[model samples]
Target chain A: MILPYYIIIPLLAAFLISLIAGKKDNWAVILSVIATTALLVLSLFSFISMKDETVTYSMSAWSLPYGIVLVQDALTSFILVMVSIISFTSLIFSIQYIRHLSMDWKYYSLFMLLVTGMNGVIITGDFFNLYVFMEIALFSAFALVAYGSRAEEFEAAFKYAVMGSVSSFLILAGIAVTYSATSTLTMAKVAEVLPTNDQKVIFWIGALFMAGFGLKAAAMPFHAWLPDAHSSAPAPISSMLSGVLIKALGIYVLIRIFYNVFNAPEIFTKIFLVLGTISIIIGVFLAIGQWDMKRLLAYHSISQIGYILLGMGIATPLGILGAVFHLFNHAIFKSLLFYNAGSVEMALGTRDLRKMGNLMKILPTTSQTSLIASLSISGIPPFNGFFSKLIIIIAALQAGLPWYAVFAIIGSLLTLASFMKVQRYGFKGETTVESVENKVGWRMNTAMIILAVLCIATSLMVVPGIQEVTLDPVVKVIADKTEYIQLVLGGMNGN
Target chain B: MQQNDGMTLIVKTVTRISVWMILLYGIYIIFHGHLSPGGGFAGGVIIALALLNVLLAFGRKFTSEWLNISFLHDLESASATLFLVIGILGISLGGAFLANFMNKGELFALLSAGTILTLNIFIGIKVGMSLFLVVWVLAGSKIVKGE
Candidate 1:
């Protein structure tokens, strides 16, 4: 029952904001806050209810595999929680961040639409529905990237939109091929029938899906547009893009389709591993040279995503667990880092680390929170990043892939060095320019503080009881492929 | 009367006569969408084209009086909301979201296909308004060039 609200609330709020917000800018902010808060509560409730079993809702009372359905399993619930938390915080941060920009109401409306699209992507059970939601997210993100309307922003948005549309076309092509092969659009039914199909055709579909989703995920060879798009957008939007958009639209869908629908083959696993390794090494090498603060963080996003992919590539129970955990942790810390970059830009009017010095003296809250996020991202102990990285390495070794574990460690070290440059150039040195006092808004500070706390708290999920309650079900769903088919198809037959 | 703002008098005169015909055709297509080849989107685009013809013939100042961009924006939002509300009505009526609750009616009547007609009407209004606003914004931005 609550599944529909996940999409309806944000959608309704977007339209309502558009209708009334022209009269008063504050109404957009207030209404968005209320809408996001409701989403957070609903997602938490859904997550709790979906702990033990899967809940499927058939649209228009049509039987499963026929009507558009929304299925909430442990994996969907986990992502729902991640998206709502980050979006709610980003909205709070934007309350202050967007005030200086023109057309704030339009910003809010598009932001809600983006949320609605992401939620739709996460919850929809059909491939065509997924494509529709993906476009909704992509189009809104394109507009949001160009929200500043600078020449550079426009250029970046154009590049992103072109690449995004190309990827979408590839996905549609893949779906066309898939439907032709299996004669069905439902994911579980497709998965069930896919095994008996032609191996050559299956291979082609897998290749297309990998390329399509890899571009969206910003994997190594397909990562040209991310640095620009991530750096050019306003800070909160940047955080949202890096934090959840790439995950929900790119990596999560790839994992769901490949793991659940296609049943991970050895060849695809090898492809994932190679792509993951390349992105990890290349992304960091690119980051270390960047002078701009947000650009560096953007590059690091590619690198961290490489870690998650590597974990997925390992394809062991522990590996999947590590990957899922890293996905959640990255959402928290990466958004926090982007928020820090935003605060720096807000105060100093520049993103070049070359121009910044000793911000810890003035912006105590911002600096400390940034330090926490940086350490967490760099895999320091007692932070969430460390545990997830540890699990991935151990899982890889357990899967008899010591070399891959070595590559994971190498990526972590490079991440540490790159962030060290950030700490030294952006926060540690004495003020180079005459120090100007700028008052950081309480709303912005509060959002950062909340994420910082989450960075520490999420580490507790490594505990036995917590892991069982929160992550185990998701791991089971992914690792045990037959159960997924049985659950979805069985529900349909019962109906 | 030599009007400097608009196009030639012949184009203006022709547009004045054909615009109403185009609008009438658009409405016909929208209302009969349940039984016809052209539905809400095509009809809505036709309606937008009619308005665009008016703008082309009469110029900005003349059309600005009736087709205000902000009003079009509001209408787009309102129609979109109305669409969602209709979907919600299906849920309230004990069906799934977007379930066809209204009577199927006789094969091809104007009053047939309860929700489809209403939905088509909403989509036509929303699409027409959105296209109009897009054109207006693009034209308006072009006029402000040297800023």
Candidate 2:
């Protein structure tokens, strides 16, 4: 019952805004904010209350095997919390940041649609339904990427669309193959039936999905579109894309499919390891070379995603724990980092690191919060990023993959180096502070501060008692894969 | 009204009679969707084509009075909203999202499939309006610039 509202609220907000909100965007803002806030509250409630439960809501009252079901386990709830929190803050940020581009209701409507798609993806248990929701998210993302309407923005959007289409088709193809092989659309039923089928079928599906979702996740091989699309969008949108979208549409789906549905096949997990390593090393090197502030941040998104992938690929209990924790932590600090980039971009009228001067005296909140975010991303202590990365490194070493751990450590060092460049040339360039084009608004600053606060606060998830209540359940969901079959099928009261 | 309103007289004359017939045929398909292959989507495309036919033969000037972008947009949005409302209504009345709240009626009958029929009507309206709106905005006006 509570499950559908996650989608219904944002979807209703989107249509209601489109239907009623006029050229002016005040109503749109009110509707979207209310919707997102409600979602945030609902997801948090579910995350706390349903920590140990596997609740499923069968759509249209059809039994499992025939109907699309919405499942909420620890993993779903955790990702739900991440999506809602980021979207809520991003909405606040957008109320101001998007105004710099245009004061149109269209942005809010599209924004709500994006939220709807991601929430729908997180909740649905049917593969076809997931693909539909993914398309909804992708379409809105393409439109939003081109929201600026500059030539370069359009070019980036075009590139993203082309890549997005190819990936979507691959996903659709994977779905078709799965449906044909297993004769079921429900994930649990498919999982039950897949083992009896030929082993090669699973490989083809895994390969197809990895190529498809891997492109969406922007892993090393399929990472061309991330920088342009993320950098080209407006600031708050940049945050949403980097901080939440890839993780939601990319990593979340990958985890659910690879871990839960496919039961973490060794071959695919091996692929994840290789992809993760390449993305980590190459992405940071690419980041250090970029002069564009947003572009550099975009490259870092690829690298940080690599960290999450590395954690997930390790597949041990601690590795999965680290992956899940890092997913949330990266979402917080990365969003904060993008907000900093956006605020700075607005004030300085540039995203070039060399073009920026010291912003310490001006835009104090952005610089300070950015310092926290940078330190967090660099795996400095007292912030959540360090703890999650340490867990992954330890897990790798524990699993007898010392070389992988070394690579991860090297990746962490490259990340620190890259962000140091962001700090140095971006905020402390020799160029003196001069007249600024824009002033950071309170709404945007408030949004940034919320995530910045979370950057430090979410580290509490790792505390012993808190970890049992929160992170433990989520990791158990991924680690003990067989439990998913029972949970989705009639073993638990999903209602 | 003018000599240069649209295409040849035969096309205009044919369009005046054919558009309504096309719309009538589309309505038939939508209402019979639960029993037939052509449901909301196919019928809706036909309906949009009917209106597009009007614009083709009579030009934008003739359609400007009752047919416009915003009107179609509102219609599309209103129908989609209704469609969602029907689905949500299922939760309140039938215990699940998009459940068949109303009596499903007898199979192979015109009124069967309960909410699906009503849902189809709204989908048809939305799809038709949306398709027409797309064409209207993209190439609805005069081809020559400065219209």
Candidate 3:
């Protein structure tokens, strides 16, 4: 019953903000903060309550496979908690970040709508419903990207919109093909019927889904729009887009469909492996040369996603666990890094690394938190990122795929090099230009500090008991295809 | 003859007569959406088109006099809130979210389909007001640039 309110709360807040915030910008901030905080508490409560069981709520009491259903399995709950945390922090950060912008109310409204879309994507149990929610997230993101109304922002938004619509069409085509083959739009039912379908047709549908979701995830060949779109958007928006949007809407669905829905076929695994390796190498090499701060981070997003995909491609228990854990860690540290970048931009009014120097002197909080994030992202020891990457590497070796392990290691090294460049040019030199002496806002510092602490705290999930309670269920949901099928369709068979 | 900002006298007069008919037809489509093909989205677009007709017939000056932008904005938000409230109502009645709580009247009745009628009306109003606001803002921007 609480499942729908996850979506309804943000949506209602969006409308209310639009109605009242035009004359009073503070109302918009207050409403959005309250809404996101509520969502965080709700998601945490739902996660605890449904720890070991799956809960399915059918819309309109039309029964499974007929009406839309909201399913809260282990995987959905895990992602829900991750998304709510990141979105709440980003909303809090936006309260002060958007103060000087025109149409501030609209920014809050679109931000809430984006959260609604992502939550809707996570909980939906139907294929078409997933597409609808994906559109919601995508459309809001497009608007948010263009919110700055600069020439570069508009160009980036246009490119993103065009490419995104193509991906949507591909996803729609894949959905149509799946319905024609399986005669059902429900995810669990599709999984149930998929094994009986023709292998060739299923393979073709897999290819379509890979291309579509890969585009959304900004994988190697399909990643032209990410750097521009991420770098050009406003800072808080950049955090949201880079932090959780790509994971929730793209990689999360891809993993769900490939592993749970299609049972992780050999050919698909091979494709994922190859794509993951290419994205890792290309993304790192491309990132090493950029001087623009956000663009560089945007490229690293591609590289980090490659690591997660490689982990998934290994197709083992440890591999799945590592991938899910890495996904969670990346959401935290990456958003922390973006928030750090936003603080720097707010204080200095520039994103160019060549022009920034000696930031450790004035902006102590920004520099320290960014250093933590940079180390975390680069997989330094004792941080959450290191454990996940080490697990993925070990899983790859255990799976007898040493070459993928080698690439993962190399990607981490290159990630370290790129961040070192960011630190050297952006924070460790003499003041390149006159320091603005602009004070960082308390709200922005608070959000970044919280996330920086989380980057270290989340590493505790590696403990056996915590891992059993948290990551084990998500891993089981992805690893055991039969569990998903039984959970969604077994009720009909009275099993 | 002097030139006006909008269309000619004949076009304005015809638009004035036809817009009300379009509005009525849109309302009919919305109310009968549960029994027929047209529903909230299609009917809402029709209503938006009728408002657009009014905008085209009368210039910005005339339209701005009565069709306040902020009022339309508020209407859009209110209607959206109304639709969400209807969904929440289902939860309070010991059912799932959006569980269709009301009793179904007889077939072919105007009040059939528990929450669908109320939902359609809200959607119609939301879509109509939002579209009108979009057009007004776009037109206002052009005027600003022209001046």
Best by DockQ: 2
Model 2: residues >4 Å from true position, as ranges? A491-495, B140-147
Native-vs-model 2 lDDT?
0.90
For model 3, the docking class works out as medium
Interface RMSD of structure candidate 3 (Å)? 1.4
Candidate 3 lDDT over A156-184, as tens digits, reads 99999999999999999999999999999
Chain A alone, model 1, TM-score?
0.98
Across B1-147, the per-residue lDDT of candidate 3 in tens digits comes to 223767889888898899999999999999999999998887888998998887887787777775777788888999998888888888887377777888888988999988889999999999888787888888888322321
Predictions' DockQ, in order: 0.76, 0.80, 0.75
TM-score of each: 0.97, 0.97, 0.97
lDDT of each: 0.90, 0.90, 0.89
Q: What lDDT does candidate 1 reach at residue A480? A: 85
lDDT of 1 by residue, A1-495 (tens): 777778889999999999999889999999999999999999888777778588777877778756888878889999999999999999999988888667479999999999999999999889999999999999999999999998899999999999999999999999999999998888888898999998998899999999999999999999999999999999999999999999999999988998999888879988888899889889999999998999999999999899889989999999999999999999999999999999888888889887888788778899999999999999999999999999999999999999989988999999999899999989875556555545679999999999999999999999999989899998988888657788877776765
Give residue A347's error in model 2 in angstroms: 1.3
